[model samples]
Target: MNDITVFPTIDDIMAAHQRIQPFIHRTPILTSEAINQIAGCEIYFKCENFQKVGAFKARGAANAVMKLTEEQKVNGVATHSSGNHAAALARAASVAGIKSYIVMPSNAPEIKKKAVAGYGGEIIECEPTLIARETTLKEVVARTGAVFIPPYDYLDVIEGQATCALEMWEEGIPFDTVMAPVGGGGLLSGTALTSKYISPKTNVIAGEPEGADDASRSFKAKELIPMVGPKTIADGLLTSLGKINFEIIMEYVDDILTVSEAEIIEAMRLVYERMKIIIEPSCAVPLAALLKNKERFKGQKVGIILSGGNVDLGKLPF
Candidate 1:
């Protein structure tokens, strides 16, 4: 059994929030009566779309960058990401006055590439496979002697992510469950840790694309199952769950739910139409899962983390 207690505590999350306060956005929480009626539940949507870099990844990246040693900061930072985290880490490094090296999949959305460059990141493009991305990142780190801040899978990153849940808990509305889409599992694990410490009675749930449901599979099998070529329109969710993230989630998270691609598109459309806010497909997974199983959440108060808004407008599935 994994030692769940070894994970960062609520105090760590509080510290991260304080550290990144000046650099990050305290995004708002939105409530929609129409969405509430449709799901038959009270839902609080944390609008991370309005966040710095237009995603909650800013929270984790900023915290990580801020916690770096002077030596590490001087050496700069590097990471492999195809979406929000790439831009977020780049932006955070720029704000901290450090160089950022990014290894991005060549097939990654053009919008993401532009965003990373806009943040002053040096982009090294690799083939769209995980192997290629990792290999390219290794080369970049070797050449630049830069510290690699992974998109997820690090304690600092996870603790930083926990601040989102900590803020949600501070909102004073008691939630029966809190949900977020799982990709590499940083946000979900952080959310789980926060719920465990701050709202022990609250259930933590993860939503995953059915095509990339490794986290849900791992949860059911009681072991980590790394994904291989999982195909999903939710580009942000294509990565496998990290080992640390899986252990923490297995110990504290209540459930992992999977939703279809069509379901994701519809949920994204719902948010765009009803809330008048743009959300990426990954952000829609939690809502899709909830609506798909409305009976399970009827009459309950649920908190959801809208992970990002960095979608390619021209390539929208809807």
Candidate 2:
């Protein structure tokens, strides 16, 4: 891989912040004194759940679409996602007055599908597998000549994701540790890079579900270990980490903590009950890790990214 793809600079992130500011929501950072007392840590939640398209994926998608060349924009954009990013890219493309082709899993939630279509995305369903998703996306790109805005691996997307952390640094109080869930590792990689660049003393932590713990294994082994048939309630987190994300993670991430299915559910429930906000299972993983290992965060200031609120209430896990 090229150096530019592997190492995204702070300037790239700052540029993305400016580029996407007009298109995406500047989601607020929230804190709960009640929950802080329980966890024994002062916790700040960057509420990306309130972001456009109900996920932090909006930041990356908006940046990617906005950065497209005029010629490329005319041909439109395409991407494959099980959920959030599909809707996000669709929304970004629509806002930019271009078409969006979204290849989604056949088994993706109805709510997500509706969001993609509602934002004017043309949907093509594929089997719920990495190979199938990639194959189907190739077909869509070939047929439409659309620029493929990958969900995580692309440099522009990573830089856009980093803007979330940059905002945390600019808006919130100082934090000793910043945590986010690891799916394809987009958010985690961006968080790690931003933390290292802006707050060198801050440690970046990743929270991954036990059923999809390839990231944890890869971090420990210092190699990429892809996940196969990961069965977790956090549907958004089933994908393996990307190569660029892995590179950034290896250099900047402090540690990865894995949580069980029950712990994830408990965390989700606790956040809803105490914080009075909705978060998808994937968003709850980081808090689950903190709850499981409270001693590590005791007396420390921590930041957690609530990645999305795009949950299908009809198919509730609890």
**Which regions in candidate 2 have their CA more than 4 angstroms from the true location?**
1-6
Off by over 4 Å in 1: 1-5
All models: lDDT? 0.92, 0.92
lDDT of 2 by residue, 1-318 (tens): 546554778888888899998778888888898889989999999999999999999999999999999999988999998688999999999999999999999998888889999999999999987799999999999999999999998878888899999999997578999999999989999989988998898989999999999999999999999998798999879889999999999999999999999999999998998899999999999999999999999999999999999887877776
lDDT of 1 by residue, 86-126 (tens): 99999999999999999998888788899999999999999
TM-score of 2: 0.96
Q: Report lDDT (Cα) of residue 128, candidate 1.
A: 86
